[model samples]
Target chain A: MTNSEIMTIHQALFIVMALAVLGSAIFVVTTSNLFRAALMLILTFFGIAGLFVLLDIGLFAVAQVLIYIGAISILIIFAVMLTRGMQGMVPRNSQAVAAAVTAGIIFAVLLLLFGPFRVTVDVARWPVFSLFAGNASPRDVGGIAWTPPNQPIPAMPETYIADFGRSLVDGNQYLLPFLLIAFLVDVVLAGAIFIARQRRPAEIIEDRRRQAEEAAEEAEAMRQAGMTPDVAPLPEGAVASTAEH
Target chain B: MDLINDLLKIIGDFIAGIINSIFGFSPFLADLVTMGLAAVMLCTFAALSFMGLTYVERKVVARIQDRVGPNQAGPFGLLQPIADGIKMFTKEDTTPATADRWVYNLAPLVIAVFALTTYAVLPFAPGVVGTNLNVGVFYIIAMGSGSIVAIIMAGWGSNNKYALLGAFRTVAQLVGYEVPMLLNVLPVVMITGSLSLVDIINQQTTLNGNPGIPFIVFFPFSALVFLISGIAETGRSPFDLLEAESEIVAGFHVEYSGMKFALFFLGEYVNALAVAFVFSTLFLGGYAGPVLPPYIWLMLKAAVVFFIFMWLRGTLPRVRVDQMHNLNWKFFVPVSIVHLVVVMALMKLFVTSPALAQANGGVLVTPGAQAAILFVASLLILIGSLAVVARRARILRLQEAAVLEQRRAENIAAVSA
Candidate 1:
């Protein structure tokens, strides 16, 4: 394929993928039903993963699917199922205008930031992007064609995993930040668990008393209607003790 | 034997050749055709494996319980799966009146797709992998995790209370078990110094023509933990609480029928097969054997593992939900963390210290010393943990007895009054 043809094909693919992502994202926010919105959000995640694959970052693409679509989306749907009153359209208020203005300002800031860096961001540096341009020979793209003055560049390390691992743990690189982030995540997880633990003893007693009274009332109503109540009645003493507590 | 090892590659090349010949003018089209053919081949393999596995499971479980299983079809019921398939195809496809129709239909396909995709990175034999992914092990776990989403979808889309509860149990069980499963796998990755399953298998090969040392010998606790968590991940046997018939009436796919139900069934068996394949690859010296083809060896090991799964299913009763959660979060997770620490420490020591190597006449220079040290340390750790567990159990039992006594005293006082 010629360079221009390759570029056109890639551009077409990018446009389609970007459209899918943006469309689904908009749908996710606009959808009334929380369940459908969560599903739309999953589609947005998938489109983003596809874009990552297009960028030749297969690791991140897989991670995106694994972490976002697999874990987070499932959790979101589960929460939606657990909570009642989420099936209807979410009520909108004046805050929507404030949110839109904030989002627009952020978008403008991003554009302004990128405009200065556009000249320095050489697209050829990304071999996969260059492959779409039809200008990256296989050897050049994979570092197989390059050699240093003093040392031979080792046969392009088998897969990028090793390089990624080294970069993560190397002393001069991301090791400290990686460890810090890991610690932070652990702390956050522990805190969440502690906060969401079982209810206190007093709260449990209060809950039991309320449920017992409701059950008694339901049984009384059923008797007035000449029907037998199916619910197992709590012992009178037990209900009294719970209420006292 | 060598020919058998190369069989998949040969078939792949043959298909690619045919595609190239037809689309010679367009390389892109040729590549696309080749990929499509490979995908079809993998899907067919998954389907066939599912059929064969169902037959195997029934027969094996029946024999374990001393009953004749499905003997009315072709010789010894070899055609039973086929008959069942026809029945499934002919059955009415129904959706609940309140179901979210699109999501309901999408769930089964999602399950099947995720189940089949894990095979893409599995190394069946030498040079027979679909793709030698750098993050092959991680990719498998990631893809396998996708099924939880599908289960949740099935549960929610059905708009049934039981289905929703099943979906909740699925997220709790699968996600909880995944932690220890990944933790156990980390030691194997550290030992091999790579995340690729192909590299892991290669590292297990014999160095001087002796039989290869499987990872199970050195890390038996991890192996046990992996198998247990893997069974939970697949929702099999004692851990199959998600679909407990007595409690939830078939769980997430309760609303499905016909081929939609068939897809869920197929996905389950495929998942079992995938887990068995991974277990064999990780700890049982994948595709390594004497006087047999690599692929055959791989299949034989996987079959043995599958038989163990069946045996467990037939023998053990399903655990209660509280028991399952406690086993995973309280028992397996802590054990796995301690095991990871021991492995990392021993590995670092083995790599840095030269005294051990010199003592063993350079034999220790290889991973042998590291493995030996880890094996001994793991044994000690296992014993210690077992003691702790016993002590904890004792304390819980005493507490239970005390509570019972108090209740009895109160009952007596009330009757006397």
Candidate 2:
């Protein structure tokens, strides 16, 4: 009968979903195995979808599942497999400085653009505050009211997709951006096709001969060690464990 | 007599009331309890259907091959699934020594659970669906794609090259086929103006004393694409098993046996069954019939679709791997896009014209009008595609013939020398 009980349940669901999202995201980065990392990334997407459902935005929730989980995660796994043996380049990167700088830039941009920046400590808030204020004084931050708004949420239209789609193609609305994105996608696709176009027979033969020469050089290197192994290099424990399963 | 038609809803409501009264729970909690009960019921229904489908698939394939199947298991081979179940339960589940243990254990469960979960949004009787989510069809697509990850996990966990290879090929096939399959759903959504299964179904329902026609009649090209892509998605018939036993030895689940193997098998049949159910809902006018109950109508239509899958499996030789991708990407995808564009364009044109919109008395152009325009467009597209394919095939054959002729002449000249 009490509204408090319903609110508590809603809060509980949010907590559970948030934890799942955070835990899986952390696991995605921390896991050494590429496949497991990819799987965890899917879990993160699923949790984010649950959060979307909690927000009562069923379209976003379904779109999250349809695009992020169904498509993007699979693409990630595909890319991971293409990496040397799906063996995630061992966790410790040699280019730590470059990686850190890139990650830091992405983090800063995201902080300036999105997130619960409200949750940030005051010391970590000024750069975001200034950037959001268009380089005005930090104290003059236009969008930074750290407190959540007390206003009631606006009601979403029932046919949100219909209205949104109409606006997307409307000339005064998102038409230019929409068409630009489409053009960009087309250009990117054409570029990829051009770069990966099939070679002539002579070029293919030359490429294969080069590959053979490289392989012969590798074989020579192995033989020069004077204790050449009979078999190819495989992941540790692979061959020995094959019989059990 | 009244209660008979609405019996299932009555039983479900009764259970919800009992949960509410006994637990003194809030209305939302009581509703949750009812949903939990419905989920369990749906699982039971799916498991039973899964068992029956195995027998049906075997018998259907056997009949096509001119052989009797599973007669040794029980009278008329009706009890064959039970015997097979017993065998599966009794077999040993061996884990690979160096396998990723948690992932190996999780993949089968993940796949099986995902398959079972898709049944939740499918409308059974009028009010007998589990949840009726607004995004029911997309939810199903999302769930179906989840199996791709599980397949990858199974392959990776097995630590076998063949299993890995199988996983790669299956993922490629499923993902490629999914594009056209998911594309086919768009025109239905566009036509119905809703993504929910109920809305889609009601769109095909008789309106204003006018007869209703299934979307398949309107967009047979899309239906053909959906059917082919859906069958490929299920890994059945001519598109069965990228991990052919002769090639990769049972694929992603090659390392699985006993109950683990059973779970994979369950996922397979359940996936096929789910696709059949969705096909009926989308194209066969799900649960819409006069005489029998709506649920019965749905089940019958789904069974017919399921039979068609088995018939294809039994009759058609498995497609060459290259041929399968070529059919999906090069043909089905492009055709589905054309079909979708035609339907959307026709609907927009018809709906906006004041003359066509008013002719239906109450709404935009009637389903009949829409069907006529779309069907003709579909036929034209189908004919044009076939002509292109025929010409391409002819050119390929001529090239082969010319090459063969030159080879034969060279052989004769060498013999004379």
Candidate 1: where is the Cα deviation over 4 Å? A1-16, A85-103, A115-160, A199-245, B206-211, B352-364, B398-417
lDDT of 1 by residue, B298-332 (tens): 99999999999999998999999988999988999
Per-residue accuracy of model 2 over B241-309 as CA lDDT, tens digit each: 666887788888899999999999899889999999999999888887776877888999999999999
Angstrom error at residue A143, model 2:
7.9
Clashing residue pairs in candidate 2 (N, C-alpha, C atoms within 3 angstroms):
none
lDDT: worst 10-residue window of model 2 chain A: A236-245
lDDT of 1 by residue, A92-164 (tens): 3334456568777977645533333222224545544344324433222222222324653244446676688
Which 10 residues in a row give candidate 1 chain B its minimum summed lDDT? B356-365
Q: For each candidate, C-alpha RMSD in Å?
A: 9.7, 7.2
A-chain TM-score in candidate 1? 0.58
